[model samples]
Target: MTGATRTTEHSAADDDVSRRLLESSATLSYDPMTEIDWEAPLPEDGYGLNPEWSTLYGTPLWDEMTEAQRVTLTRHEVCSIMSTGIWFEMILQQMILRDQYVHNPANAEFQFALTEIADECRHSIMFARTCAKLDVPAYFPRKDVVEAARIFKSVAGGEVAYGGTLVAEEVLDVMQRDWMRGENVLDIVRTSSKIHVVEESRHMKFARQEIREHMEGISPLRRRASAALIALGASVIVRSLVNYGVYRAAGLDTRRAVEAAANNPHRRSMMRTACAGLMEFLDEAGLLTRPAVAIYRRVHMI
Candidate 1:
């Protein structure tokens, strides 16, 4: 087939996918403001997320903590993750906007891209409100990581942008599926998680579609480089999910808590489980190069 014919076919397929996504959004999108009971009081015994999903869970340090301390620690950890969520959501919004710039707005793909942006805007606000209701202070990634992300959001595109997005969303989706169902977790967190999981599922699907489209006919060297970049992005995100301040907030020694969390076998296992589908997807997309695998292994995400 001629190059123009191939390009037209690809565009048509993308439009079909976007049309379906738009239909899905119109049928079942949410309004977090009304979906969440922002006024409800948090139970003293409630956890911020499922205990099994905690970074320190199953560690000796976790075992040593009192019930109240555990509750506090988990709350801070969840809020920390939510803060990271907000940060990445902003980066993604910028990346999407840039990607769509000068594109045909009449196309379904462009309209759905804007719709996804709208969903992320709502998600960021929902996460911020959830953290405020949990009474936890804002948590940020390291100074260097923050600076690096600023650079990344400015130039990242194609597979790297969508791959990083899919990785983050997939990792969180696995955890939130449990959080939304955790009977011992706070009702506010559960409601918020439910909203996030539902909305982000569609986003993940869209990212996967975008990544596949962008990977077409790319060179091996570029593919490897993109894989490494995406893996690096995932490592930064995973490392920042639970800030060290969370340990101090629970009145534990930061050094010890960090050490324990780093070596916790169960926590590593949880990460591997959470990222199983993501790993498979990356592998299928030819984005799981040797270097990328090493990076994922360092974060226990493989």
Candidate 2:
């Protein structure tokens, strides 16, 4: 059999996956606007996320913090993560839009790509509302990081684009599972996380399939380059997940909190645990290059 025949069959399988995913989304997609009670009052003691998921969790700083401070810190940390989610969501939307440009609209793949973008737009709005409801200010990635992503999104190929999307989504999938069920968590945050968990499962599936399809028949040099790019993207995302401003908002010394969080063993363990499946996927796709492993380790996502 010729390579062309193999390619055609592979493409068909991708479309089959896309069609199934599209049907699943149409059947189960949610509107956060109506699903959540935006006007509900938050309890004074409620946390924005599971305390265990906090960056400073299990650290000396965490033990020193009062109960009220713990609540405030987790709330700010969760909001900061939401802010980062919005940032990455916008970038992935642009990347997918470009990937599907001028494609056959009748194809299941194209349709699902658009559907994912629409879902991302909604998720961003959902995150924004949760932040506002909690009275948490917008916490942005660094100016340089934002500018770098602006350029990356505008020009990234479908390979790194989908790989990076998978990284971001996979990291959040595990945490959202905990947040949505966390007792004494804020009602708005819990509802928002529940919505995201259900929808993002589909998005992560789509991204993994897309990356697998894109990786097929690529050259070694190209694979290595894509691996490094994806790893770099992950580092940027992990670093920006909880901005330093969150510490200040929780009324701690920013530098000290940052230092403690950076050295927190529990945080490292959680990050590595969260990324295990993503790393396995990347390895199977021939994208777990040595350089990529090094970068993932640096980010403690190995």
Candidate 3:
């Protein structure tokens, strides 16, 4: 087929996907301010997330901790993840805005893109408030990681941008699914996780659609580079999810906690399980290059 015909076909397919996503959003979107009961008192015995999902879970260190210490560590860890969510949401909002710049505002694609951005804005606010309610200190990624993301948010586009977004969303999606169902988890966290899971399901769908669209005509070399870049981004995000400060806040030896977390077999298994679907998707999309797999292995995401 001719180039113009292919372009028209691609545009038509994208419009259909965007239209469905827009309809879905209008049908089921949430306002976290109203949906979450921010004023609810947290139960003293509640975990911030599922204990099995904890980075230190099943380790000897975890066995040595008291119930109160376990609760504190989990709360700090969850807050750290929330802080990282906020950081990446900011990066994604900027990247999406740049990607849609100068595009036809009348198109469904543009409209849905903006809708995703609005969703992310609310998500960040919800996470910030949740952390405050948990009484955990605000956590941030390492300084160099922040600087690298600054460059990424400014220049990354197409499959690289959407792929990274998908990786982050998918990773959190799996964990939040468990969090929302954790009977022992804090009500605030469970409610927030429910809201996030509902909204992020749509965002993940949109990101996957965008990634597929952008990958349609790229060269093999470019695809390889995109794969590596996305893997790098994923590694950074996973590594930063639970800040080292969380250990100190839990009153553990920071060095021991970090080492225990890194070598925790159960935690690595959880990471691998959470990323199974994501790995399948990446492999299908030709983004799971050898280098990308190696990076994913480093983070125990594969």
Candidate 4:
């Protein structure tokens, strides 16, 4: 077969796959009230979550926190981490609406997009309400809004190009879900977790399949894009994990918290544990090309 014919054949194959995905899934809804469970009681002990998470913060930072600070972080930062998942989800929903459904009003993807938008709104509200219950300010600056938009824009390539992002978001979700499951979370938080767990599970599955399919045809330049994105993802993941309050209260330099957290072998290992499985999956899917692995090593290691 000629090169041109091969390229044509590949395009047709990809188009077929995309169509199959859209056709196979049932239509989704935008209704949040009907979808989530709002009455479950919070867990009694969130410490026995994934042992890595317990070990990561259970030592120096957990011990250093004041009762008030502990209450505040538990109420706010703990949930904030989960809420960050919603935050990024909502951003992607908007970006999808902006780019994907702009012309197609009844696009099937729009339904999933709307569901995420509602999910995120409720998650943030519940998080703030829980913070108020503990008298912790649930304020995230508007600048973070800008930052989120910037990152989303930069990463808004096709499903394959943005695969690392999907992996990162879901892993963070696991961390929070496990944490909440271990502790005696507030009623609101417990309820929020029910919604998050269900929705994120579906989202993660969708993203996983989509990413795997998208990675089928990779090129060297796009592979480099994947590499850069994975590196940025590591930075984003670490920064997201490094709580500013944790550093300030621990009497460690807040300025170097990310460096310190990344430098900590245990913490780094924990992060790698969270991400490495997905890394291997991507590698098998041909998503983690040579360039991407090199970039991953550089950012993940000192």
RMSD value for candidate 2: 3.3
Q: Which ten residues in a row have the lowest lDDT in candidate 3?
A: 1-10
Which candidate, 3 or 4, has the higher TM-score?
3
What are the models' TM-scores? 0.96, 0.96, 0.96, 0.67
Give one clash count per candidate, in the order shown: 0, 0, 0, 5
In the range 1-302, model 3's lDDT, one tens digit per residue, is: 11112232336878898999999999998888998888888889999999998889999999999999999999999999999999999999998887887777888988999999999999999999999999888899999999989988888888888999999999999999999999999989998899999989988988888888888888999999999999999999999999999889889999999999999999999999999999999999999999999999999999
Best by lDDT: 3
Task: State which candidate, 2 or 4, has the greater TM-score.
Answer: 2
lDDT of 1 by residue, 187-214 (tens): 9889889988888888898899988888
| Candidate 3: residue 250 lDDT (0-100) | 85
Better of 2 and 3 by lDDT: 3
Per-residue lDDT tens digits for candidate 4, residues 170-280, read: 566656566546545454555456556655555565556545544556676765676566556555554553345544543445655435444556755666666666676
Please report how far candidate 2 places residue 249 from its true position, in Å.
0.6
lDDT of 2: 0.89
**Model 1 ranges with Cα > 4 A deviation:** 1-10
Q: What is the C-alpha lDDT of each candidate?
A: 0.90, 0.89, 0.91, 0.51
